[model samples]
Target: MHIPRWAIPAAVVAASGMLLTGCGKVPPGQQANVGVGAPQAVPDPARQDPSAAPSQSAAPTVLRVAEAARLGKVVTDAEGRTLYRFDKDTARPPASTCLDSCANTWPPVTAPKGRIQVDGVDRNLIGKTKRPDGLWQVTLGGWPLYRYAEDDGPGDVKGQGVGGSWFAAAPDGKKAGGEQQEQDDGDGNGGGRNRWAGWTVVKVRQHPRLGMIVTDGEGRVMYRFDGDRPRVSNCDGQCAKTWPIVKFTNWKKLKTEGVERSRIGFIERKDGSCQLTINGRPMYYFAGDRRPGDANGQGARNAWWVVSPRGEKITG
Candidate 1:
């Protein structure tokens, strides 16, 4: 239940690749009391398509279940655009942590001032909470709903696991992806979050901008700090807040692809937590890198550099 030091809300996510498929049924015994709301036209200025104008009609905001490639039954808006929930947000009290700039990227699915239509989703689980801006945002199973701005149209779920927090919403207001439910592994990270079977724990990706960069399990590019000696990490405190260390507890759980298994190791931090390392260099996740394929931490301050599959620093 603890939020990380560098925790940001959400962003566009790459699709999770796995062969698993099945219909996700809502768990039983979950019931809440809330009034129905009629849908109205809510403007989303951050929409990717500038040519797509806002709807002027008074149609109800339709919430329904749809099938995703690997994520199975997921919640989508009337446009078929995938809706997501933030892991940092709370469902027990029906609160949202995504705000300001985060809200700009992941727009809250604002329920119209009046009744919403539902399919597959339990209407009893549907409700609304007043955002700080005084807008009535839609909520499901007490968890607020949101839409990824980068998701172009129907069937586009480009925001599946950004920042290790964002995920496609299931009909029952739980994290979607069929049988792959979020389970805590005692690290407070909810186990391999959004990671599916055959997903690599460490791998080499041919980044279009950085080329042949090392990526963590979720495909977020990893970095190495020049300030640290081999097997030691100097990036802690506020430095760690900006570049969170790659943490792991079990060695057997670390999987790799295109990277040598011998190169993968770990170092105990001053905090008593084990941080994943590659070829003796400590690994990190840049807080600025919102999603997979992002190498925003590359050449940062001329000290931080993205690592390559060979466990060498990537200069370009």
Candidate 2:
């Protein structure tokens, strides 16, 4: 992820807690560009090089709705850069998962002091979530807001569709993208595409990092929880939230590529939702996986692992 060059002057760093501290302007100096997965040392504001170039002025602390070419109406920071929400993050209670190195790549949009201003969006839907770092990250409709580091300037939506989990946030805090494309219903007979096509069809895709692995219609890699049993799922409540079950209906009409049809099936979840299965083990989608081809969920918690077209776990 690219580092952001936007400045916030006199921005006060409050102590660690989940409370909205008074928002302040950002201080001067470059918001350090760090390598992904490695922590880069940031300069202490107290000590600085006098000859260092000054940082740019801070954009007004306003959240606005802008029309994006691909995603239509999207929430943007005062700078007009596309704001995003992570699927791994929750909204009902409001939380964030993009932390540390992730934070460096996708900086949280800090909450403004006092009431927030908006344009072409419902201000009542705006709220805030206290980050682990004590900063109150702004939330629209309970979804935390963020700015992509790769977006060099306003109107850049490089962060859209990243990791398949990050998306340009809609004004109401939903995923913002153009009208859904028609899906290829597995059988030759063409009916309207299933609204859940992303989780409906299975395929064998060549992931740049994970090699040949099983994926859903949207090309997101699939995984099986080791703790689960045949035709059963132990993931529920919070666990279910993190690893959303592969939901599908009309198993008979399911599509596949490189996957064994005989090995495919479905298990009824406690909530009565149908979860797609391979060789009896339940399938799931990891919240951490932001986009297609991402295998970030592999080996998670020594339990979750990617699946292969053969319905076998991909280990090693």
Candidate 3:
């Protein structure tokens, strides 16, 4: 862990106002457009007009739990927003490939006649799943659950992993942040082994149109290098083979939250190893962004982008 550059832009503006609360302050590169196309049915303030009264027909579909300091509890809705899951969608028999405009940008969390309302969750892992317009939706362990129309408030997880197959939603149904989990070892023969242990060596991941940035520990996407400076690192060799460098063997078990353990530092490259770094720039990873949220190198030629934990950059 090295971080320096005067503590990388006020610890990325105090971890981007603590992982983007309400997310409306927009600035460095604009924000709020997230993930781009396909998902546009907006309008459902819990479906207005039930005679339009009791606070517009009582808009509280209930199903709570929220704490997200890098994603802990999560799973919200009785007006608390944040709820997602859809790695192409499928949970045993529960399915929902995010239809029509991706179900108008991930809406389906309906309870309809199922009349939902659970607090700390676990009503036998909450169930329900039929959407194809048949409504129903809301399922917990069997997956199916949604929200994120670019999430505006209520503990806003900004839809956590967005296009990397969305995430955020764990009250046992799994996927509330931390990410990278593979571990199978039981001899089932799937041969697993990718684990960041307790995870979070750096957080914030979302990009419907690039609303949140900074990733790592398997969620990938992390760049920055306006031609380098502070701790210096002008690419190197074929630009470090398309842009690899983002190392950190242990760094004392690094496990950043919103980011800012003094901005976290470590440079020393030229091949002698030791790369990482945030406020002092020098972070990379874009061999064309093979998977995990892929930023494709954000703005690339204009000098790369995607940093923001308040360290700015982001580009668009």
Worst 10 residues of 3 by lDDT: 31-40
lDDT of 2: 0.66
| Cα lDDT tens digits for candidate 1, 173-256 | 888875344432212223555554432277666687777777764667899999988766888799999999887444335555
lDDT of 3 by residue, 19-137 (tens): 22221222332222111101112343433534321221223468888887788898888878888887546564466656555566776776765377899988798888766445677
lDDT, model 1, position 131: 65
Evaluate all candidate structures by whole-model CA lDDT and list the values in order.
Answer: 0.67, 0.66, 0.63
The lowest-lDDT stretch of 10 consecutive residues in candidate 2 is: 31-40
- Which candidate number has the best lDDT? 1
Q: Candidate 2 lDDT, tens digit per residue, 1-316?
A: 7422121111321222111111111122212111100011244432243323112133245888898886788999777989998754656456665655577788888764666778888988888888755567888877788889899988889999887668898887778985332222222122354444333677776665666788876677889998987766889899988999887555334655556444566654445466777877889999999977788899999999999767899885
Q: Each candidate's TM vs. the true structure?
A: 0.42, 0.42, 0.27
Q: Which residue runs does candidate 3 get wrong by more than 4 Å?
A: 1-84, 88-100, 108-116, 123-144, 147-171, 175-192, 195-213, 217-221, 228-234, 238-306, 309-316
